[model samples]
Target: MTSKEKIISFPHMGNYYIAIEFLIKHTLNMKILTPPPITKKTLELGSKYSPDFVCVPFKYNLGNYIEALEKGANFLVQAGGGCRFGYYGEIQEQILRDLGYDFEFISILNAEDMNPFSVYGIFKKLNQKLSFTKFTYYFALTLKIAEIIDKIEEYIRENIGFEVKEGSFEQLQKDFLNRLKTVKGFRDIDKIYKKYNILFRNIEINKPKNPIKVGVVGELYVVMEPFSNYFIEKELAKKGIQITRFITVTYLFKNHPKEKELIKFSGKYLKYAIGADGTDSVARTKQLAEAGYDGVIHVKPFGCTPEVNAMPMLQNISNDYKMPVLYFSFDSQTSETGIKTRLEAFYDMLLMKREKQKWKKVI
Candidate 1:
């Protein structure tokens, strides 16, 4: 069977699918099928086949694979990372094979470790005629695309709450993402980003002098994928809270601080890199607290060991600074209603705290 006829797909994790698709299409010689968007059906399907206690992301990925496979995706890819995440590809591959699906998978583990020769070998296996130079170009372009998107998103998170016209930020963001799908090279990515940057700035806003500011720090997947966390950031924004999140592909691939740096940034609250994104969560929360942000929300999938490990340290920091920290754990069985209710209460409490501070100043 000729491999050129195969279709490639990877699990969706937010608007980053455009970057993933751009890389695969430009570098590899196979057709790409963007997985169906995550939905209730996707979660249910993923949960059904997944191990009873596995983290929810694992189930979501499996569900994405099944949906893609059903749509004729014979080639699959999974990202690699630290903690339980690094081993996900092998286990998912095993489970899929046992379920009788025939497909190819590559777990491109860890961005730091994917050197030129390793990348060349991986791509060469799929397309023997692959040009290392060409692949390298597109790969760099892919990283650039991801970096640009991360900056745009950080801006959106900060300003999305204060837009004078509802959905202006969101609608502009949607258009920008659609434009990303058609990018051909570095020039295209730069043009799209520049265009959107101006447009995003021009959107009118009525931000208060002291808006309720919140920083989000958590497990990588939950922080990056809005759906995974019940769109917690969106809910916060809907309450007119200015949101800031430092985690993104740019942080992971381009600007991730070293272990020692993470410890230093986190202050005495953390002395060790707590594995995966755990240390960064602690550090970013500390930074947010010191920066006078109103609160922090830390999210993770149920049973995620790294984020769980960081919780005590987070609480310590929260206590030290009197900063409020909200925690949410997601699972296949997590309730939408419970999440919304807790979020509403959290927003109200933050508002109350800010009002109380003002009254004390008045006296």
Candidate 2:
């Protein structure tokens, strides 16, 4: 609200804020307010204002916008476009207006059209002090940082389950992400990521050469946001299951080029994109089955039409390949205890199946 100070805010989606914060700071020199980490309170706020049947991501994001507005953020950013999210910005803006909040709502919904110059234009319009040359430099660095963070996270997912010391990998991940926030440029990013990658590798773990691997396939938001999925990955890891997921912050930067391969792989099941990550889900589940993974876990929000459409195809894949698949649809009202019990049953089944396979090979 102050004449000289402008605060821009966006919803939380894992550690993605770290790179976003670096970009806004180094390029536009604007103050950034991050919505609080998603919690039970956040879900409640979002659910109360949102349509009862909207996907879970909508409620969570609406809650984020409300809380950010309450905390004095004048500019709200909604950076999603795939699926119904493309239409959510205007709807959320209207809802907030109805509630009497006066502010600017910015949408970067057309992610495919985004480029360095377009991004520079957005910030330059907000503040004339943003230099095109400086923005270019920082933009490239910001992308590298995003990719590095994703890579480090993937490493952590693969190893965290078997750490010799409890919280060892987690503590390293925490330190690394916090340090990432203070890094000024590419050199700092490279140095910090390398140091942490080394530390993560050196951390003692008792992983079997071939471990139970579960590939997570779903709508990107539900798969990537821990709150939305009830921290399923952490629970699976605690049971010593290695996890693989294709969605990440960097997937946006790459424009999901892997989608071409996904189409080819899923052609027998689905010939065209069903929207969002539907095709990718089918393709990834098939890929995991072919690659000898123990199982596949599909996570999506309730009323997710694309994922719903893909479910039949996934069931076909499950039947043909004899690959075990677990499907989870989450909303604000989803019960944590129910999810925990179901996961336990699935893990037990997979363990027994593996043991049977081993016995058959020996016989």
Candidate 3:
């Protein structure tokens, strides 16, 4: 089938649309269709059809598949790990079939046969008409774009709280995305990034006297997609809290090996991998605690198993390290106001803890 006849869909993860844009630009006749950003309705739909105890990412992605099918998407692409997620494609496909949706589904990562070549083969199938040379060229460019996007997002998360002007970082981010769309080559990408790097660096920032730092972890989908989580980071930044989220596409795709090393470093504490993202969540929570972060926010979809398994361990880490951690489960009926209130309370508790630490040091 030609690229135009295929529609690629993945769960709402960080900057996936950016990655999709890179794919479309490189492949001829390809049209991309992303599921609408996850919301209360998404969770409701997902929960309605999914097994009650299924992982949250499963429900979310299932909901996405259903929604995309309803919206004329004919091809679904599932990319993830060697755990239950590796098998999600089969289950989700069957569910879609039962729902009477006619579509083609591709699972990119096959646990038993996973290799670089296997991965490249999937990409080749997705764009069968593209020459190998062209595929290599576009893949390289996409990696570069992913790196730049990750760096920019990390910078924003770390510094957005200090912006002297409200929405300055967001506005600049919008401008950066617009500029990125105009980039046609490596040189153009570098030029745009360098210009914006300097522009953002020069912006005056007022460091909060006692900044509340929150480390976010959980099911990859909700944590990575701002829209999926109702812009939770933005709301925290607006409250003048510095936010640190450990999940990024660059880390997941490019630095998975290094992360694997870190997981090994966790050793016996994280003995069994509950699922795809469970191991990473445990390691990240520990790292954040060791880094002296004030608090951690764990966001998961309603039925996510890996994160559910990680939560008890996370609580143990929080207690041992004397750090605060908040857990939030998102679904269609979850109230935004409730989330905001919890965040406000978490922020207040962190600030008070910092004050106590200061007084203790003074004494």
Give the winner by TM-score: 1
Each prediction's TM-score against the native?
Answer: 0.97, 0.96, 0.86
Q: What is the lDDT of candidate 3?
A: 0.76
lDDT of each: 0.88, 0.87, 0.76
Can you tell me which runs of candidate 3 are displaced by over 4 Å?
Answer: 1-11, 37-41, 109-116, 257-260, 267-275
- Total backbone clashes of model 1? 0
Quote the lDDT for 343 in model 2.
99
Look at candidate 3 and tell me the lDDT of residue 153: 85
Query: What residue pairs clash in candidate 3, if any at all?
Result: 40-332, 55-303, 55-304, 56-303, 56-304
Q: Which pairs clash inside model 2?
A: none
Clashes per candidate, residues 3 or more apart or on different chains: 0, 0, 5
Superposition-based RMSD of candidate 2 using all C-alpha atoms, in angstroms: 1.6
**What stretches of model 2 exceed 4 Å from their correct place?**
1-4, 258-260
Better of 1 and 2 by lDDT: 1
Q: lDDT of candidate 1? A: 0.88
| Predicted model with the maximum lDDT | 1
